[model samples]
Target: MISSDFDSDGFVDIAGLDSTGRYLLVYFGKGANQFHGLTRYWLITKSDKIYSADLFKKFIPNLISLNKLSGKIEIYSFVNRKLNRNLDISVGYYPENLMFDDFTNSRTKEIICYGKNFGGISLITFQNEDYKIQKIDSENTYANVTPIFLNSDEYLDLAGISLKDQELHIFTNRNLRFSKSTIKKFTDRIAHLASSDFNDDNFKDICLISNSTNELIILYGNGLGGFPTAASFDLQYNADEIIIQDFTKDNLTDILFLDNASKNIFIKILKENHEWNSSIPLTKFNNLISFCLYRTRSQIGILCSEAFERNIFSIVNSSLALEKNIFTLSSNPTSIEVLKNTDEVINEICWIDKLDNNFCILKRNEFNTPERIYRFKLLRQFDSYVINKTLENQLDIVFFSLGKNYFDFVNFNLSDQSISRKTLTIYGAIDKILFFPTDHDTPNVAALNQRGNSNYITVTNPFKINPIIIDEPLVSSSVSNYFFDSVERILFYMQPHQVDTIIEFKSKKFNPTYSQGETKNHFRAEIKKGSQVITHAMDLGDTKKFDILNFFSSKGDGYLLTSFYQTDGYLPDSKEDEIILHDKSKIKAVKNDFSKTNEFYIYNENSQSVESLLSLKKGKRILTKKIKEDKEIREFTINLLPRERRELIYLRNNSPFIYLENF
Candidate 1:
């Protein structure tokens, strides 16, 4: 990945990787000087199982060959691992914009380079093996953004919106043939064209937004023949750029747009019938430049910012109504992603905050509420960034460029909440970072950098250590159990043997709190049985993010059997190891199967534990065994618990067990 540190205090601009798994950092010169090319190309390598960094004092001589050119120069390079060589190429005069498209086949490796200068798009292809350079096409009036490759073919496609004419051009193949008939003239500059299945026809359509128009346009047909018929709708707010995503889990395309002048956010929900149902203002701030969206199981997360501060929010009920503000902090957020299936919570959001010069995490619940979790500050600001969640929930590896001399490889554990950092030096200013996982089980991280003199490439093995596993579990206990008079409900907490315990309750009150309690309910003894492994906790309150009763019962045995529930009073914190039961007749016993093949359960009179129990894989039948005169029910439940501290078990036979306790 290539990133630019526009806010960096020093002259460092870009960072990337070299051929030998090393990092290359590049710094821009302060003044217009011929000698003001790449100041340094540092090399980072691994030896004796440790990454070492050093300046590449020898690579500086490569500048001697890139002496003089007629126009201001812009350089971009990529490493062809198959050919074992780096190709350095440049565009002159108008070099502010650049795009790269990689076309790799069995016999040939090619990269199509396009950029805008005083002229239009300058197109060139670099052949990897032979190091051959060929100029295919150039237009004097068209400026181009990064070219996106649509498929795997010898031909590559790129789109450029003409700065002078306000026309969209589609360049086909490396031959650079412009589809003139397909070019559409727009009233404003086309900021971006995103691909999505807007009609659910299994064909990806293009959603285009313009910098000067508040209307978002959708082209319905697949890209195989360009956009078919286009439709435009006036947005509630002006949109500088728009993004299409399935934010509401409705399987229909939704829209997120950013206002260039006001720094406000707007979301448009697409209904199941492919119509824009609602357009609502999400958030507003000053100097907002960009925004990105990430989807979890139950909610949509928005990562956005003003000029200097970044904020995140989620939509509740898929309603487009702004319900809760998740995270608001002082930093510029560059990127965000949701880590999947790593915890009991729906997902974890990770972002790079520039103001704090650190990375941060926002814990998201199934109901869309978010909590500030963890933050880690780095020694130097990042230039560009990319992150990956590895297999088996192993670790979240973040590859970011630092300063003009190195790339930082950092690893974060989602389960245990730990972080490790390493730095690599390269031969140029790192511009982009990409990860290529090989079939042989090893993966290499590729970094692209621009040295003032010539372009350089770097590659590094990011795997430094074996995956760490946590064997401990998080366990907690609660005592006070009471029901509120207004809601006519009861509340309790369950302490599972070795699993993370839960606080649960059922109430008619849509929103419940301690103030609503009519009387104090108490339990004599509640013992916390396992480890305290969770570093952070999020109390989602009565908001939709948390299903209090359901969340508690989904883990193991139903709350009534394993937890202390009281409808009339509160338990003192002093009691331990004993159960004080009142109104036992109010608790009903219902037979239900706990088998995976026939998992079903029934709720008792006025008790919501059935909802929680049903959420678990197995039903509540295991807790319904007949009580014998000699054998106590409590002893049998305790005996059924797993012997290992963090053992996985299934309620039914033959089914694999998942991690029951948090670690």
Candidate 2:
């Protein structure tokens, strides 16, 4: 079935087609200012890869045959396309709320029609281009609402009692004979019915609204033919309409009821034990037209209307919270959908409305802030609009109007607290808005206005493009660690090893000298690059030279040595000069060929080694013969200054050991 904002009218008209792809629409409207009552019909057919239709000459005559002259009834086909003239049947009464029943071998279409002559109920069947009507033999004569077909043979008829009280009449078709039975009766009006497995019993449970007492009735049975046991609860609000489905994923049934008395809607959840638990208020509005509940795996869409405006809201399970202010429309919302298994996480919400003399496009975001709302207006009169969501998350909105004309699709982004103001003018009347998936192509918008009685003025075409992208820069390059000084200056890009060194050096020396220190005992140190330093040092006894021998050693031919020296001479003569010294030696240039001589000696024997002594003689060469002895050659070089002494050592194998006496 497809609905259209025909003639850019605020109301959406419904159309249906049979399996053979034929159109059957009723109660058609002409334009924005013309509603042809509930008597017009149009036949649509597919030709040359397009769905085309014309005014069927027999529609008005058939409508007159189905109504009671004084009372009016609108025909609504439950199928998607139109009715096939070859299979069309002339049956008794006008069909309202028509649906198909295919549970049996043959496809049977069921409809509810009421007239003064045909008071009780009637069923029609079409086969071999012939129509047959079967009057349901019942004792009660009242206006029958619609008959709901369950499975193929069983059906439920909601008959009204004097346009006030409602009752459920169950009918079963067996051996081509119809049997009618009154299952449940109430003192209220029956609004709607939904069937689902509510108690995990594998049976279809029926949920219907009793408007007389504002209560919801749940009837459970094994099958449509089995006896049904029912329970009723006072809904506490006047239910103008109600829809039932499995919304909470608990394998139980839930309901959404529209309360016109309070202008509020309520959701009732049926527990696993067949008990109606809590009811929560959904939304409040005035003059609610209709509501639809489209269920997905995760969420449920509540599509409703207040006055002429339509709104769509979603209910999330995690917090049991309802996301509000989703989308609002100036025209009536025709259809709503909660999509499943799309690439996007948020399901798409699409609706059609009328704006001025054109039709407006209404859509909701399905990913990220999936609740972001958008609206657009189109030109030309249409019969139906379809909104399709493809695998790529692209939306296609298509409209079927009487004739093709240029349309200006204007979209707007509104603030959360701001109302949208219509700024564009459309010249042509719009009919319907249809959405379909485009093959990687965006839709285009056009504007056309009436130039004269038969001609129209066209405007420049405008293409709708996706919004812009914004770029943001990172604050810093460092990822793991950060630090700050006393003055609140932040430092990033710190290494792990440097952090250990800073912590160790600070813990060892209490009174360290710093480059910016102003106190006598305290000093400041600033680490700019390689390593940390001790800003101040405590006085450890008189100046002393301490030698700590190697306690542990490895065999890599590399050695590390650490020496400690204490000085008490009123600091150094120059801060740049060495503060502590053990031995002093001056290096001198050698005049002889030191490379040919194997034996070399030094006064400071502590540093006498072949490698050290030869290095002191600048530009000197050294050579050695093939010596097998472990203790062969050892040399050293010594230098003596006025206030300092130095020594260097060189050794070959485990060469000769040197000892020094107190200087």
Candidate 3:
């Protein structure tokens, strides 16, 4: 069965290939549980199985039909309320399953088939305005085939269970020619196959369910990318199909299986000690297929359904000790209204730069010179030299080390606002120190050794608190911005561009939480180069300032529509808080304190949304006050600062506030 807005009415309709009756069935959905039988068209006289897939990835539904008698396969597109014939090819064997994918990076998707008498596998591709059927050099029958990128190559490869040989084969696709297939005799008589990063080692592993033997086989992968052998576990005695999921919420993949003999569901959990334990037992009144990776909003879990059972089970696990039955779907729950995701409001876009070069500070006049504009200055100084601060006197023991020929400690009593300095011997000049959590210490301690012009340094017991020597770099090499995608393990670095080693480093961890009060803040900017996705990245800025208005000037000549964020903290979602620009195609970033005196447009005075340079020069009356002298009150009026605030009292406060007259 497949679904789409067939008439383009913005209403989804359902279509299915009635294999038993050999009819193309269409059901028009008026939404809200209302569906009417639209029409039916005769498909084929002798039908084995009718398959529907997005063969061309048009997002429009397409159908593939195979004849049981002649083993003839036909491809059709839905048009004019009938199957429009596109391509037809005959396979010598009756194919049971089919997949539409591009294995050779040829951009054109090929129809891959696995079935009886098909001799391993068959690939049907369209070329020269004609369809052609080709066979990979192999002689066997595969139960199921899954395409995976098991290597660093751009093309996709295949993995399947060769039924005749009773072995698992990983086919590395080599261009449009023949593939290099490595057949591993792991388990016997494999029935079902699935490929995922089961162990979460950043590499995909192959899982197989054996027919003759009731065993679940896991082709555990190495981080370097190869599943050399199989790790077998005893499943239910009659388990037929399986899937790998984190059913236990351990971040480690667990196994779920369906029993062929009875309508029973079993889960084999991978334990921390490299063993499998059978999870809570569940029995259904009908048959089930192990599939459906479900997501309810941001929360993700498993969804499973049985044949005769009129309900779909939604299982959510917080940990191994507890589980929640989150939702129960109706007899045949197809789709739900999902909240379309907009770009998430920008969070803390901090400049975590070690260099204190660009810091803007605003110093406005406190007097009632409402006509005068605010002035800002840039001072070069290292910000956030203090790691942690506390009001309690007992928290005074935390010290920062300035390693000279001897170790100098600057201890502070934050409540008393006093500091005491002491000197003891260590190494050279200390660069960066971090206070990370440790089980050995009551409170975390500063961990670092002297790092001056050295690429790496080993920091042993700093004041003997959390004692360990870690030889890590003080920072990524002169890194201005480094964006790491935890999902893809791709590290993109923006340096001097002279470095020329952008994609060399492998990111160890992502956004690791720093100690309390410490920030591992990152900025984001799009950096796209061809097909490579380096869009989400932000380098640290000078830590001396808490606020920064960051922007990436487009190297291209065009005005950009972007999002604006204030780095002070969390901000509200407003349409007005967007990137505003004039007709200029280029962004001029002057290293001046212009943003320090950034002004907001006076909203109610006029409906205009911004105070551009033109509006600021007009000098409108912003503040009004009446002074009483000799029993005669006189009204005094003054202009806004660069067209900023209207009230004199609020302008004197330096922060933003509203004037409510006499109230």
Candidate 4:
């Protein structure tokens, strides 16, 4: 059976050979589970199977039929419910099966088939308006052949099972010719062969079922035309057919088989340790010739074709529950449905080929899960997601709050003057939030919000009392904005405002405790002039006297002298260039240090005076003084310089501080 949009009407149509193999049955799809009546075309009486291809690369697809007895292949162009013979070629060997694949990566479908009775494999390709056949000789006749990507190459290789020799052969494609790459002899005769990325290693692996030993042998490919790993599992039943796919949707390739005796379907999922889980048996299927997997809106299902009935099975919770028969064909019906079930149910198109020049299409409207548990595991729910440790061993799950257009704003009361308030109404819903832990009680949060299809992210002062809003908009949901590296505490997100795209944010371990006070003794130190220890009182309008210190007679080096009045300790021989004092509060810097630069000044401001009460020049050093205080405020740093004008700044008592620097 073959399916395509034959009329280019966006609906799938089907065509197949009748029981006698002489007549071609085509049915046009009318959609909504209906098909047009029989459109029959007389062809060679001994035709075996029918295949369809888009030979002209147009929307309309054409049909190809193979005659094994006559060793002839014919291509028919189906237009307006009519068949026109376009080409006929005599392919010498009696090819049993046909596979259409782009062997050369040329984007054109090439016909590949293996001949019967020691006849080698042949490749039929169209070139220069003629069908060309390239036969590759084989020492052992293959029972079945299929094209597989044995290596990470552009061309497709061939894998065949030789039942007579009890061997599996892999032929590598090189310059449109196949060369024997690997031929492994098996102790038991292989029944079926299937290939997939079973280990999720990006390399395609091969799985074969041994009919005699009832064992499923797996040859793990190395992506270099070699199987470095091999394993076998006992089926415990005579397995006739095999398929490898992600049946459970767990991103793991599972093994499925049809029992030869009872014709029941058995499946086993591959675990991460390369071990098979417990084997599960689905409901029995009678006279099952071949089966394929189909997907519905909610779950994945199976479609099996038998002698007289086409059975549809839904996989629910790991069990295959048989659905009601979708089609009951005549005694000698040759029905065909769209075998590619990758699309949704509404897109499915099916047609059955009745032997007596009759064809019918099935309208599948019902589905049921099996009595056993077959589950569909959900891998993700959001457009994207990320996990971060907001607290120690605690997770603050933040994802795209879908359909939510608002967020709750909460503010914690830190003093008696401020009351705790929660506001439920806030516009521009938060699409995503990222928590960046810092050395404080509060974390640096990066928030994302959307307004009128425009996304904006706050990199600084995010989720604060008055959150700082950046003017520029961020990338949309379709583009990747940031890459958060939890291991290295780095976030590489999109920052369009950066000149060099400096989007990396390296974080530190979150510290939630405030800075504690120390019990160290406090002393007063003065920067004296002319190498003489003389403390000059800092009063209002002392700038004229302070400027005269630069005219010292010797131009002598200045020194900082420490004096302790309570204990009578004096630093007479000390040559300390800078004096540092730490009050009960955290003061980051006082004078010019590496944090600022060399040759900077500090001005002591008094509320009563227009000019600074005292201004002193400090060279290449920072000083911290202990001026005991009781208020808890965020640590802040102030930058001041000399010969440069300074601005008047006011700080309210017991309020949080903002860092200010005058460069």
Worst 10 residues of 3 by lDDT: 654-663
* Local lDDT at 117 for model 3: 56
Candidate 2 local lDDT, 1-663, one digit each (tens): 332433323433432332233334333433221234442334332211111111122222121112233223233231222332333334444333333332223544343444324456555554544555667643554543433344434434332333323556665656346566666666656655556666777665666665666677767766644545777787777756666665544456667677777887766766656777556564567776545553222234454434444332322211111223322222233323232323433333343443233333322332222233355455554444444443243444444443344332332323332222222234444322222122444432222222233222222212423311111111212222111121111111122233432211111111111112221111122222343221111221232211111100122222211111122111111111211112111111222222222222222222222221222122332222221122222222221211222222122222111211111
Between prediction 1 and prediction 2, the one with superior lDDT is: 1
How far residue 39's Cα lies from its native spot in candidate 2, in Å, is 20
TM per candidate: 0.36, 0.37, 0.42, 0.46
Higher-TM-score candidate of 2 and 3: 3
Candidate 4 worst ten-residue window by lDDT: 544-553
Off by over 4 Å in 2: 1-99, 114-118, 142-168, 184-195, 222-228, 293-302, 306-663
Task: Identify the leading candidate in terms of lDDT.
Answer: 4
Q: How would you encode candidate 3's per-residue C-alpha lDDT over 416-530 as one tens digit per residue?
A: 5355544333354543344444455323333344355432233344455444344454343543323333233223333332232222222333223311111243333333332
lDDT of 1 by residue, 412-486 (tens): 665676777777666656555655454534345655455553333345665545221111111112222222221
Off by over 4 Å in 1: 1-88, 103-118, 129-137, 144-154, 174-182, 222-226, 241-255, 277-285, 288-663
Residue pairs in clash, model 3? 120-140, 351-541, 352-540, 352-541, 353-541, 383-544, 407-424, 523-538
Clashes of 2: 60
lDDT of candidate 3 vs native?
Answer: 0.44
The better-scoring model by lDDT among 2 and 3 is: 3
Q: All models: lDDT?
A: 0.40, 0.35, 0.44, 0.48
**What are the runs in model 3 whose C-alpha is more than 4 Å off?**
1-19, 26-39, 80-82, 181-183, 223-225, 228-230, 242-257, 265-283, 286-663
- To one decimal, what is the Cα RMSD in angstroms of model 1 from the true structure? 24.8
